[model samples]
Target: MPDSRDRKARKRDLTPEQREKRQARRREKRHASPEVRFILDNNTRVPVDLRPYSLNWDAARIGDPSYYVIGLAKGGSTLMHELVRSLCEAAGRTYIDVPAALFDQGVEPARAVLDPDWLRSRDGSVFGGFRWLHPWMDNLALHERRKIVMVRDPRDILTSLYFSHAYSHVAPETGRLADTFDEQRTQARAQSIDDYVAGPVSLRVFRNYCHLLALTRMPDFRSYRYEDVIFEKRQWIRDLAADLDIRCPEDRLDAIADAHDRQPEAEDASNHVRQVAPGDHVRKLKPETIDLLNRRFAPVLAEFGYGTAS
Candidate 1:
């Protein structure tokens, strides 16, 4: 019983015919080309310059029980990874290597979460974007509600770092143990947990840790020590797993130790390794060099309990 003017007003709104036509148009657009589809999907971006970088991760791929290893340079993370894998293997659970997984981890969520935006903001302003990456990098967000933590030791860390960088003789992959190992790391290969002492890698790793601290306000952020891992393996691992609300079998840790014994003799083959071994650094380090390391890495070492002992 509406008048002509009212009916005209109603007609101006979306009507049955209008709705049908609009829906038809949307249906057509759904089948459109990739380029057009992208334009439609990414309309929220402001007029920012499109750099070679981006933070376009999906943050939803990794499973709930997943973990991230935020190890600093010279930390015993490589051994940690091997140990974790051995444990996970014994439990019949899978532990993906974070260091190497960033490069094409053969999974859909890995793809989405490793996008442009997240890639860009990993560390300093220089490496922000899809172009930059950390070896063995794993997005905490991708873990689909899993746990992420860092483990390290204080004295051994400084000792290993000193040898890792300015060794008048230490040369890893990049050069003779100089600035970085990244130049030689394969873009196709995932991160390596064993490359703990490869230059200033921890400098970058710490930046990532800072980012995580800012993003997640959770109280249970984790940091473990290599000593505890070596001495109180079961208690610590079990505690870590419990913090993450899961059951970690101690037998897996034992298996990891056994597996570690089976690896290359490279660990025991070199003097550099020997110098950095537990108790050796304290005995061998020149007083000045020890002071220098303690000074430069004081903050990190303190967090890991270095100052009180050596």
Candidate 2:
């Protein structure tokens, strides 16, 4: 049998009739299965069957004490995660850092069987961050938990993403995933930033923003804009702390804000913190590219109080 990559390549070469036939066969096979599947916010199906066991085991033990910081990959999630970790430490709470490996491999099995134990092992209030929403999270019952979703201007996010994927973001020394990242880096280097943003990367970023927006409808969920976190550091920290019910002191808030206030003297493509300034897209992207992104991201811009006006 051909590998998945080979199958995909061959599928792309199929005629319209052949594609329809393949899709019909897939539908039949899906209907034949008794296993349950979840559709993620990104419109991808979770391949794992979620039947027989619930993802929410040990719910009473876990209870609503966990805090989750979820957002776009390059959208200040690391900064927020560190700040939350600081707050957890101050309160003597356990900070559970979910391994990126779980996400990379598949969160379905972990969520169904392992997450509760992991969350329960930590004492007191537990808080951690996830890079983005995953299909398994849909079954985790977040409404009772304190969840914050961070969003950046999709334009700035694209600018940051281009640099991160092409240069700054680190990959493993060797692996299939590392090879994929290498390919992406090469492609990103070859294309203009505008072309790179206009490609599939834009869709992924926009979908993340949409998912983040959707979470705002949950009772205990809040959304924070990257611009506010950067420009109005103190006020933003206080607001975030209040939302998460953390009694952060003025001095501590100042310390946290000061610690993360990064302003690099120069744009270093090799550095993870390439540049912290907002609206880098205005200077880097073309007029037409900016206009297109502004239009495409109008809903997100308006919802997050980001001006859509050129």
Candidate 3:
């Protein structure tokens, strides 16, 4: 009923406490909404449909959740998993390979949602080998548990992915997943690295990095970079073990790090350990492609302290 000037005057007349209360009420209303949306830089909205899962805090307490080590694909997850498994062995704890089990059954991380009951049953276990964060993982009631996320430079990730798919990664002789890998290999071989990294095939990798950043928003989640994990293996292992409450002798930790510290002298496309050096993209990708990747991944680079493209 009031005119525009009258409404503006009323808004300006509100006291600080009144304004704070209004903002709090708006936040509460927004949190009460069922749909959750994440807005990326290019005005792309990723809608997470949370309707199927029970997001209630009480429901999340169905079982005792294990510690989780999540990684971005081709981001040193395999090594991290091995290190965690070694630590678990030293600590006399169970290490559950969730991803490997799922992979054996032909379920890739992108195509699978972790079973709440299965997770609930694994009390006091160390769960490793996860490479993707699905929205359904939010259903887990592990707010008090320690979760580790590993990430790498997006450009390096793309370079490694190209080589892994086109050359090194092994695929089974048959199955839908094998067929999918075959298609990827064929495409990777047919296209230049620049085209492959900038094209649609690499979009999922970018999305995974976005999800990794989002997961870091949680109080219990800590993110580690692949560079640090590689260059500073002993300290990284020590810090991670302390965070997970795993007690191991310093000598044992040193032994584990020493066992995996061997780096290849040169890039070998046929082997999984192609190269461990950072900035491989500078050597592999075109200048324009690297510039485009920097702009596209500016948020991740800045957040993770990788330095933006010049």
Candidate 4:
């Protein structure tokens, strides 16, 4: 059989423009709703006062989340997702895959494929994020209610991402696995040394984390931490349940064990797993490299309790 990567190449690798086309179709579908149409075209011209009409009856009537879990990759976001999934299952509450649309096709898929009425308030609905999640959360008129939002300390997130990137895209399956934290730097140096020594993983992680942090600035959001999830699963779930105004089940929250046994290892599924090991990158990254990452990602690193670089 063909390798899994090869399968993904055909099934998932869509170009940016192709994704835009998909989103256009999804938006067209959303626009077809009478409520959406009223809000868009005639909201300004309405004779009655606008504030009451802006209310979200759906969120008021049936409680199902359409919120985003915005956080850096490998920042325990995936495990948090599993925990939330488990909570919903335990309570027998429907997990609605937010019918909201997506634009980009990479971390986020286009909204075009989602039906305007395609809400799955049943159990175990898998919702795509990094696209649909952002927009859905931002639209105040279209309330997602609330869901879990988590962030790990940047040091831990940096470590996990570094190693994961190395194995997933750079390292080989054969004899030698080069954790070249000095990726592309050793060769391109003498001219653009700073550029060469710069870590790609650090750059991506910092930027995405900063973006995720910005979401809490929006109203109706609840923030969390990796430490809280790891150390206080029950409290974490309770807090999340309160924000979402949903009942969290006792059986759903599980203790943090060597969860890798129950799930895939970071390196094995780092690129694609729903959950990844936090801070595994520390082993692969050298001390100097960590310092370099600290400097490069100081903004987000500081925000996540890593403190300012001296």
Candidate 5:
């Protein structure tokens, strides 16, 4: 029942070896959980149980459970993350991003949330983050939670993925998870977005998209369209807030949306307010690539009420 400040002070009193031991144990628990792996393998749905080791990262029950927002990598997750964080802060709750442990391997330090101490500190706060995989649902069964899946036009997702890699810090050498495109990623970086879309990069995006779509089969999952997140920001924010039980003023919600709104002209990947346009795929994709996407992603596009590329 100690205050956060007291917890921090006490944590600081621990010996370096003790801290290292705790960290090692946390890493072990994340990797060694058979139940989590089993649920993931079976694609287990609602009314599941979350393992205590995964939930109580620090062996203390001080952190709040997460309300997750999951989606494909380039599927407007950043914008949704910004809006969610703002609402959480406004509602006096802490917001946590995706922990690297939730991923299968090779987590970048900046995005990793596996630290036992950090996860425990957000007690009574909201946990928000993206999961590229479906098995992550297992980790949430232990707490009260809601999930939001962000969907984007597959063609646009490919376009953004190309630009995100070409312009941003994400690259094979940067420890990105694009192992499938390793051979061609460097060449694709120098090539035009159009060419990238026609090459291995396109396949990478397609495979990732399909991977995420497979999770839709699981029950109790709700989704947000990337286009809705961009154009219908206010309504989306309001609805999401209601779903997560975080009440915020409409004006405040609008302000947060405006602040995080995507700039259609933003070419800077590092800039949070990146290009916000829907259908950039039309401009950047070749006719053949467009055909391929329409054919390959037809089911998802149809299910989400998205028309094929022009």
Candidate 6:
């Protein structure tokens, strides 16, 4: 009659022999190529190159013309990017997608579009900067810059991240970023949703969620929910356009909203775009896992108004 949390604790208290037996069963379920998992778990593999995201920050100007769409990973930042880009087009401005790895201190700004000064030089163009962190806005700033920060229910964010990593971790043909981190081995070795929630990726995401919540409190940034963006694209666009001083004609804003109004796709068992509906974690996560996350991220949930964790 023990609940899942109690059962999980009981398993952890098993004797040595029983522990070995449990591990043996886990090995039987794992489908990874042996060598890669060994290297990843043991830290023997070469590190994946993430240098492509080097953020060589430059000096800020007083009147630099730029706008930023900032959000956590899998938190509708991509959709925010598209919405901002569409606004730029409607306003006769150029949309510049900033690279994720722009923090590298030494590299020169090779691309003209990435240079804030170069962007300033071009008339009728706006820098549509998309990044996760707030400090990224410091160096690229001008007096006229605007920032739109997006947030999502952390439960949905966690669920989406799990599926994304789940696909990336085990499926080699999918060519996912998870493969880069684990060499495509970890998920095949995953035992359950409980294990996945406690995995390295989820822990990192938790840290980021905490960090992002703190950053969101800073002044001069407009925040919106992922739900609002999904259910109210037109009003969201209008609000964003107004903040950025972009005079998006009513028809153009409607057209952009209509273009993005396609319902969440249904065939995405991979959960790609299929069910962007919120609260996916309710179905995908076990009771114990939810309790664990609730305890760990209680502050973040309360900070963002997702309701206080008990």
Of the candidates shown, which would achieve the greatest TM-score relative to the real structure?
3
Give each model's whole-structure lDDT. 0.40, 0.68, 0.73, 0.45, 0.60, 0.57
The parts of candidate 1 lying over 4 Å away from their true place are 1-65, 101-113, 116-148, 153-155, 161-218, 240-253, 256-280, 308-310
Model 5 stretches astray by more than 4 angstroms: 1-66, 100-125, 134-145, 170-185, 190-192, 264-274
Per-residue CA lDDT of model 5 for 258-296, tens digit only, reads 887656564566553457788888876778778877887
Better of 3 and 6 by lDDT: 3
TM per candidate comes to 0.48, 0.71, 0.76, 0.51, 0.64, 0.63
> Cα RMSDs of all predictions?
12.4, 13.9, 12.1, 16.1, 11.7, 21.2
Model 6 TM-score (2 dp): 0.63
The lDDT, on a scale of 0 to 1, for candidate 1 is: 0.40
Instruction: Write the residue-wise lDDT of candidate 3 on 1-310 in tens digits.
Output: 8899998998899999999898766554443333444333344444443323211312222234568888777888888888887887677665666556445444444554544544544355566778777665665555656788888888899999999999999886543567788899999999999999999856787787777776677778888889877989999889878877889999999998888786999879999989999889999999999988888888888999997653
As for candidate 5, its clashing pairs are 62-123, 63-123
What lDDT is obtained when candidate 3 is compared to the true structure? 0.73
For candidate 1, what is the TM-score? 0.48
Off by over 4 Å in 2: 1-64, 99-125
Q: In model 4, what is the error at residue 108, expressed in angstroms?
A: 5.6
- In candidate 6, where is summed lDDT lowest over 10 consecutive residues? 31-40
Q: Give residue 211's lDDT in candidate 1 (0 to 100).
A: 46
Residue-pair clash count for candidate 6: 12
User: What is the RMSD of candidate 5?
Assistant: 11.7
Query: RMSD to the native, candidate 4?
Result: 16.1
